[model samples]
Target chain A: MRFDVTILGSSSATPIYNRNPTAQALNINERFYLIDCGEGTQQQMLRYDIKSSRIDYIFISHLHGDHYLGLVGLLSSLNLNGRKKPITLFGPAHLKDIIQMHFEYSETTIQFDLEFRATDPSKSEIILDNQDITVETILLDHRIACTGFLFRQKRRLRKIIKERVEELQVPVEYYAVLKRGVDYFATNGQVYPNNELTTAAEEPRAYAYCSDTLYNESYFEQIAGVNLLYHEATFAHDMLDRANETHHTTALQAGEIAKITGAKKLLIGHFSARYKTLTDLLDEARSVFPETELAIEGKTFVIES
Target chain B: MRFDVTILGSSSATPIYNRNPTAQALNINERFYLIDCGEGTQQQMLRYDIKSSRIDYIFISHLHGDHYLGLVGLLSSLNLNGRKKPITLFGPAHLKDIIQMHFEYSETTIQFDLEFRATDPSKSEIILDNQDITVETILLDHRIACTGFLFRQKRRLRKIIKERVEELQVPVEYYAVLKRGVDYFATNGQVYPNNELTTAAEEPRAYAYCSDTLYNESYFEQIAGVNLLYHEATFAHDMLDRANETHHTTALQAGEIAKITGAKKLLIGHFSARYKTLTDLLDEARSVFPETELAIEGKTFVIES
Candidate 1:
C-alpha cells in the first residue's frame, strides 16, 4: 500500500506573498483526509488537483484564523458543487457555533450531512477507527487548547505461495485459510504447517501531525517511532526566546522532539513571515536531526514502512 | 487629477474559483477608497498592487458573506502590519456588532481605531465627503437590503497661464483667486478677467458601482452619465428568467442599465460559476451596448471625464 502526505500551506499566523496558511492532505490508499483548513484552502486544493469530494474527514487543531479560517468557504463550495456524502469534522466545541452563526446570518442551508465531533485537547484519545486506519489525538502545550493527531494503518494479510500449496494438494477453496496463517487439514486427519506456505504480514505504517504548539516533551512518548512526523517550526533557533514567549516552537526544538521520539523522518514547517528564505531553518533542523526535511508547499512525501 | 476605477472581484453569494467576490478600488490623486470587501479582497488588493495603507475608507454593500467575508481578515492583517491610521468603515448597523463579536471571541484588541458608520441600505444618502471625492449610496433592488455607490471626484482648480499672469502683474497671493475662476484686482484697480488668465477646471470624473441587484431602472437616474459604470452581471442572456427569480441581473440587463443611464462605458462582471468562459457574456452585453467591456481580474479601467 502507498500512503503519502501533501503540504497545502506552510505559513504561520500571518499570510505572506506566495505563502498560504496551514493545511495538509493525507492520502491513505485511495481515500483523502484533510487537516487544518486555513484561509483559501479550497482554492489551494483546486490548484493542486485534489478531488474535494474524496475527502471523508477533516481534523482541525484549533480555532485560530490561520488554522481554520478557510473551513466555511470550503464547506460552502462543497455544497454549491452538490456534494451529498456525509463529512465528519473534528474540532473544538466553539467551531460549530461559529460556523452555524455565519450560515444562519447568510440564510444558507447546506445540501450534505455535516457531523461535528468535539475533541478534548487535554488528553490522548481515539477519535476515529476503521478497518483500514485508526486516528488518535495527542495533547500539546499552547496558549490555547491544541491537539495533534496520529494516524496508523492496519497491517495487511500475508500472500500464500501457490506452488507450495499446490504441492501439498491443497484445494483452491482453502487458500483463504492459508492466507489467514492457518494450516490446512486433510479429510484423513493429515496436517500441513502454515509456516511452509506463507510469509509474514506487512508492518503497519504510522504518520503524525503536530501544529502550532510550544516545545513540550510530554507528547514524545505518544508519537514515538512514527514513520513520518510533521511538526510546526515557526521560528529559527535565534528566536528561541521569542518562540517560548509566543507559545511556538523553534526549528531546533522541532528537531529535538523528532530526535527524542525516534521518528523515522521529520518534516518541519509553519514558517513565520519574517523569513523570506527557509535555508536557515533547514540548516538548523538538519544540525540536530539529520533526517529532517523542509515542508515545501504542494509537495508530497510518501510514508514507507 | 488622475481618477480611475479597478474591479478586483465581482461574484455574488458564493465565490467561485476564478470569479472573486465583490470588491473595487477607486483611486483619486494619491488616495484610495475601497468599496465592498468580499472574500479574498485583500489578496486581490495585493495582486493588483493597491496599497492597503492608502485606503482611507471602506464601503460595504450589505451583510452578505460574498460582500463582507473579507473584512475581518483584512482588518486582522492591518492590525498584524501595525497600521496606525484610523480606518473608516461604512456599512449597515449590524456590521459593527459582527466585527466586535469576532474580535472579542479571538481575544484580539485592535491596535488601530476603526470608525464605523451605519448606512440605511434601503435609502439613498451621502455616505462620505472629503476634499478630493464625494460618495453617495443608491438604493438597489435585491433580495436583501443592499445599496450601490456613486463616487465623484471634486472639481479641481483651473490651470493658470504663467506668462499671462506675469503680464498682468498679478501677485502670487492673487493666483489662488485666478485658479478659482475669479477676476484678480491689481493695486491700481485694473480688472484682470478670469478667462484670459485661467481656463475652466476639468470636468469632474464619476464612477458608479452596482452589485447584486435585479434590473431596476430607478437607479439609472441617480448614476446617470457616469464616466465609468461597473454593474453585476451574474448570468448570461439565456438565464434571464432565472436571474429575475434569484434577484440577479443578466449581461443584457447590465448593458441596458448603462445605455439607459447614458454611461460613458460599462464594465460587466459578477459571473455565475456555471459558465467557464465569459466570451458569450461580453458578446451579449456588447450586442446591447457596444462600449461594454468585461471586468477582467487585475485589470484597471480608468474613469476619464
Candidate 2:
C-alpha cells in the first residue's frame, strides 16, 4: 500500500504570487482524502494531475474563505465533468447551508451525491470508519470552530505461508479463515498453531493534519506517534505575538508540538504572505525538531510506520 | 500618451491550469485602470510587472466569485506592500458588503483609502469622470447582476508653438492659457488667433469591455464604434446552444456582437475549460469578423482610433 501526503497548497489566509492557500491530499492505500480546499484548489488539482474521481472524502477544518472557498467551484466542476459517485464531506454545520445558497442563487444543480456530516469541533470523535481506514477528529484552538483529522489505515490480515498451507492440505474455501490468524483443522481433529502457518501483518500507517490552529498541547494526546504530521505554521518565531493574537501557530510552535507529540516527521506549512522566503521558517522549525520539513506545493511526502 | 490594453487573465468562470479568470488593464496615458479582478488578479498584475501604484481605479463586472474573488486579497496585499494612495472601486452594490465582512472577520485594517461606488447593472451611465478619462457602464446579460465598462480617454489639448509664443512676447504665465486653446494678447491690444500658433490634438481612444454577457444586441448602442472591444466567448460555434442555454456566448456570437457594434477590432476571450486549443475559436470568430483576435494572457493590444 502506498501511503503518502501531498501538499496541494501551503499559504495562509491571504493569497500570494506563487504560494497557494491551505489544502492537501492524504492517500491511504488506493483512496484519496482531500483536506481544506482553498480558493483555487480545483485548479491546483488539475495542475498537479490529481484525479478528482479518486477523492472519496473531504475534511474541512473551518468555514474561513481561505480554508474552503473552493468547495462550490470544485463541486460544480465535478458536475460539469459528469461525476456521479457520492462524495462525503465533513465540516461545520453551516457549510452545507453556505454551499446550498451559492448553488441555489446560481441555479446550478449538481449531479453527484454529496453526503455532508457536521463535525463538532469541541471534542475528539471517530468521524469515518471504512474497511481500509479510520478517520478521527481532534479539536483545535482557532477563532472559529475548528478540528484536525487523523487518518489511520487499518491493519492488513496476516498472509498464510503457501508451502505450509499446501503441506497441511488446507482447502481453498478455508483461506479466508487462515488469513484471519486461524489454523485450518483436519477432519481427524488434529490441532495446528495459527502463528506457525501465517506471517504477521504489516504495521498500519497513520497521518495527522492540523490546519489553521493555534499552539495547543491538548491535541498532542490524540495525534501522538503519527507517522506524518502536517501543522499550520502561519508565522515565524519573530511574529509569535501576532500568531497568538491571530490564533495561529508559529513555525517554532508547530515544531515544538511535533517534538512533544513524538511524531515521526513534521511538515510545516500555511505560511503567511508576509514572508516571501521560507528559509527562516524552515531553519527555526528544524532547530526545534530535526526531522521537520517545509511543505512545498505539489510535493508528496511518504508516511512510513 | 501610452494607451494600450494588457490582458492579465483571459480564462473564464472556472480557472484552468496556468489560465486565470478574467482581468485586464487599460493604460490611458500614465493612469492604469483595472477591469474584472478574478482570483489571483493581484498575482497576475505582479507577474505582468504592472505598477500597483499606477492603478487608480478598478471596475468589477459582477458579483460572481470568478469575477471579483481576488479583490479582497489584492487589497490586503496592497496594504502589506505599503500603498498609501486611495483606490476607487466600481462594482455591484453587494460587493462592498462582501469585502467589508471579509475584512472585519480577518481583522485587517487597511492603510490606504478605498473608495467604492456601486454600479447599476440594468442601466448604461457614466460612473466616473476624471481630468483625463471617463468610465461608463454597459449593461450585460449574465446569470447574476453584471455590467461591463467603457474607458474613453479625454480629448487631448492642442499643442502650442513655442517659437511663435516667444516671438509674440507672451508672458510665461500666459503659456498656460495658450495650451488651453485661448489666444494670448500683448498689453498693446495686439490680437493673436488661436489657430495661428496651435495644432489640432490627436483623437482620443476608447476601449469597451463586455464581460460574461450573452449575445445581446441591446448593448450595441452603448459600445458602438469603440476602438477596441473585448467580448466573452465561452464556447465555439458547435456549443452555441449550450452557450445560450447557460446565458453565455459562442465565438461566433462574440464576433457578431463586434460586427454589430462596428468596433475597429475585436478581442475574444473567456474560453471554456473544455478548450485546450483556441485556434478553432479564432478561426470561427474571424470567419464572421475578419478583425477578430483571440485574447492571450499577458498580451497587450493597442487601441488605435
Whole-model Cα lDDT per candidate? 0.86, 0.85
Docking class of 2: acceptable
Highest-DockQ candidate: 1
Across residues B218-271, which tens digit of lDDT does each residue of candidate 2 receive?
889988899999999999989988898878999988888888889899999999
Who wins the TM-score comparison?
A: 1
For model 1, residues B63-84, the per-residue Cα lDDT tens digits are: 7777887788788888878889
User: Residue A73 CA error for candidate 1 (Å)?
Assistant: 1.0
**Candidate 2 ranges beyond 4 A from true positions:** B51-55, B76-86, B96-115, B188-190
Residue-pair clashes per candidate, as listed?
1, 0
**How close to the true structure is residue B78 of candidate 1, measured as C-alpha lDDT?**
85
lDDT of 2 by residue, A2-100 (tens): 888888899887667788878898887778899988877877898888887789899999876678766776777677778899999999887787667
Model 2: how far is A265 from its true place, Å? 1.2
Which residue pairs overlap in candidate 1's backbone? B10-B270
Per-model interface RMSD values are 2.0, 3.2
Overall local distance difference test of candidate 1: 0.86
